[model samples]
Target: MPIYSSDSDSYDVSSSSTRLFQRERPLHSILGGGRVADVLLWRKKNVSAAILLGLTVIWCLFEVFEYQFLTLLCHIAITVLLFIFIWTNGASLLNRSPPKIPEIILSASAFKQVAVTFHAELNRSLIVLYDIACGKDLTLFLLAIASLWILSVVGTYFSSLNLMYLGFVAIGTIPALYERYEHEVDYLAGKSNRDLRKLYKKFDSKVLNKIPRGPIKQKKSK
Candidate 1:
């Protein structure tokens, strides 16, 4: 019975994943499954996208022959640089000045659909939050799995995986910290206002009653 249940669960999980990858969005990607983001992200200059497509074609042709490390490196390098340029510019495009605030936020929402780093961080947060909310045993189990995965990857890929690990950690932590800082400012402002109100009431009831009069006009004369 237990084995049958496990098999059923496994099938359900795989089906869900397959469905998710099959979905589509306009430009960036088709709901995270990855797509040609011509309309979504690459709406501007076509030059970069054209070059990337060209290189991808070449890479594919090479791959048909065999997996050449040089070809792999060339393709990966181009893709990585492409992403860096896009993200750096995308951040600005996502959050323009107050005049285009609405448009910017909307773009960010759309961007999130294809933003791989954002998705990865969100998934990480969900896993951690779930473990914390569930129970200590579950949390420990998750931690063990996470630690083992990191150890194995880093051990097996000392050079490449090390950079990937650092990149993920940095990207995940930075956004979260920015969110916390914004919240902290809001909290402090609220707390200060609340404390000020209490002090006014506690010290002098008339304080609230007094009119906040402007500067008294000096009696003309003397």
Candidate 2:
């Protein structure tokens, strides 16, 4: 003979419900899970979509409402007002000791630091060029340069809005599609690589190898 309490029945029901939810978790993940949620919330690559959306809105406003002069006026007014407010009340708001600019931000030292950084980066770039010219990455380096030249020329012909749309579409869809069909994509890419390598070898032998070479420089006695 057993006495069954209502609370025990409720506890059993709750436990069963929890187990059911746990079972559905994987189904939820298979459909569209946390990664999709994060993308919808504009994480990482979705940020570009968000920016493109913002630009699209601005372009619409400019085109539809003729907001050019109004936009300029609003910008100027807001900047002036903010500047005045800061100039007038900044001291009281800060209420701290003398607010001198940091030594790093000061004119001469900052300029020197910038100059040094610029020269360091310039030297690094020269070293990279030398390595590319001397090493096996020369073909990749030339391809990159040619790609940049083509991109610049294409960009000059296309309007900013067109380029933005292209970027938005590519950034939004390409990664997700690639992730979804990665194996198939890889298979296709491997096939393409084989074909390209064959073509490259044929071209090098027939066309490039026959190009006239410059006279080799003989080393002079020191």
Clashing pairs in 1: 25-30
Worst 10 residues of 2 by lDDT: 12-21
RMSD (Å) per prediction: 23.2, 17.8
lDDT per residue for candidate 2 within 91-199, as digits (tens), equals 6677844344467766797698779867986998798677776756644566568888998999998876667667766655665665555445544454444466777
Cα shift from native, residue 7, model 2 (Å): 69
lDDT string for model 1 (21-96, tens) is 1333321343232332332233333644465455556545554455567867888999978877777777777884
Clash number for each model: 1, 0
Let me know the TM-score candidate 2 reaches against the reference structure: 0.44
User: Which pairs of residues collide in candidate 2?
Assistant: none
Off-target runs (Cα >4 Å) in candidate 1 are: 1-109, 112-135, 138-153, 161-222
